[model samples]
Target: MKNDKADFIPIFDGHSLAGWHPVPRLPVSRAPGEPSPDPDDERYRRAMQTTGKWTVEHGAITGRQDPPGCGYGGYLLSDGVYGDFELLFEARPDWPADTGILVRASSLGSQGFQILLDHRRSGNIGGIYGNGIGGFHGINFTLDAKYDEHGRPIGLRLEDPAAAIEPMTPDKPALLDDAATGEQFLSRWKWDDWNEFRIRVEGASPRITVHINDGKISEIDTEALKHPLYNAAAVRDLLGPKGHIAFEIHDNDPGMGEARWGANAACRWRNIRIREL
Candidate 1:
């Protein structure tokens, strides 16, 4: 038996997908009976650059998204580039998925630092966004799962998990805080199964720290960032020392137009490993 985790390493090799690739759809925002983008449609940018379907069967590493819900799509990169690390994985959502887990990722200027594997109903898996900069700036506390209009999740699990801070831009207007770490991540999350996604990231204006199922929640530190464009020579290579290691299939991009999930949702990873600290 190889229960793994001996200094982490196995970045998904249960079957295939090699080092991973495909990531070309982030123009999200067309709901209300969707369907618009036709900028000389190269077949809708090759079907939104093949938005979804990164298979690998039983061992894990699935994505799904496609014609199941509606907006935003493509994602699944990671060819190499890491800095201070500590990732761990085991996410598992079936339909209402809006996934996340990209640290330092660039994929040739896509941006990263997300760690939210949204599970729908005002999702926020572990919160820590910052994609391509601009007030998408990080920190979310989450835990509000209690949907029911057409979103689902109504199994119930909310003691109060709603916190947002978005500091550099996105038109401002998102600032709520109630910390209690939302009942400690709903008593170590597990709504509908597998859960255990740890993160770490170290210095150079990057302190991040999240955990789920293992509890913890949020701990960012981007050099005491608060937003107003927390400078550092304007996002120094995304506060870099290294990058790459993504996995988010969250199309409908309008640059985080809220709602966060519930379209064709899909997320599943198995024993993904990492450890560079």
Candidate 2:
């Protein structure tokens, strides 16, 4: 019942990690109180190769930066490569985390179309990012949640993070926008609760579509991308025709103010299933 349909294949077993392998995020090291080190240095490269921490908890596969809050993050890559498919999964990131699902990810260039679930200030979910392929963004909007006086998340808000803070409660449903608005997504996303993500990726220069909590957020055709940095042929060459699916525990960049991830926060996912198109 958790799958999209009987024909879809289950990717995660829920009780343990079986078909996935961890790959640490970029070797560029940046933890609080420590000066960044050279990524090409052999010691840093080897150390970061296994730095990420992943585990199973409460029927969900979870990822957290190792050593609780002070360590960097990584990704979980599927063992098999896929050409085109529809991926369905559920996720709940502890407040202020940055995470995503990768489609047809090329390990060589770190190239892929990422379905972002960056649940932090000025972040977004259900949007596509170019990753290392082109460093381009293909989203129309972002999200910023409400925080308590102590910086603990109290609720979600679709407005800019700089907007004046006023009284609001998560107890009420948002005034949902029409599907045509494309702005309907964040309002439909559950605050601090599990939300469903459905993604379809197809073609060489892939056409990607995303729906979160049953609200459509993005539909991008890479072959026709309008961004100045996007070069279709180059991206296609880097991605090839087939690649693996992946999940990310994003690297934290302190330059962007507070750490993008929460203290000891873990992003959780379960009921992963995929249907090849």
Candidate 3:
């Protein structure tokens, strides 16, 4: 007999789980001399005095940085993976930091898409990187001048690269002129302020929306990306039906802080909620 009640399980706030996993909290941290925990690891690193600098209060996770590299940072990884869903989270950086909300990421470190939270360059927020794609893939979308063996910038444009690689339709060859793009994308950013990020993934296409203090800033469509590394098939097999969510405490160039041996930078996250559609 078919049972309609079996299709729904009541949880909280008038919400029900219909083939969707209830959100689970998984704590994470980095401590001295301790190997970094794998994103898939079930163990949550307890907060320590020197290494684990994050604190959890009222269900909100906050990130703290000690001089150079006391500990890299901390993250709360989701227990399950997600495919097509809407993710909502609140973020307020401690003294202007760079963080990333990575999805569709593989345990093998191969595939995923990152919604960048950049305190450094606001316009550059939500740019995609890594795995054969150059720095800031979608944010700027500028084409690199074709280079010869000598590394000199040839006048050839991306249209030429598209022509060389036949049968593949390159989405609008990126303009090679740097001045044409302008810096307006970076100028309208807020530093040291809490911002809301919304990422919607539907199949191979992903859309990003950013709101600063409830005011709309930018919206980007990432469907036209042709990078083979970000192909749908590769991501689907690696991340399964759903993908894991992670907060990145990227260790970039020095002068930002002291470079401690074996220490990674950090970031914090709170009020993370997702609704599967």
Which number leads on lDDT? 2
Model 2: C-alpha RMSD to truth?
7.2
Writing each residue's lDDT as its tens digit, candidate 3 over 85-105 gives: 766666765423555666655
Alpha-carbon deviation at 149 in model 1, angstroms: 11
Model 2, TM vs. native: 0.83
User: Which runs of model 3 end up more than 4 angstroms from their true locations?
Assistant: 1-53, 65-68, 71-74, 107-111, 121-123, 130-136, 141-189, 204-224, 228-230, 252-268
Order the candidates by TM-score, highest first. Answer: 2, 3, 1
Tens digits of lDDT, candidate 1, 15-73: 99888776765542222122445656654565455657778878888776566455656
The true-structure Cα RMSD of candidate 1 reads 20.0
RMSD per model, one decimal: 20.0, 7.2, 13.5
**lDDT on C-alpha atoms for all candidate structures:** 0.63, 0.71, 0.41
TM-score of each: 0.29, 0.83, 0.52
Model 2 residue 169 lDDT? 25
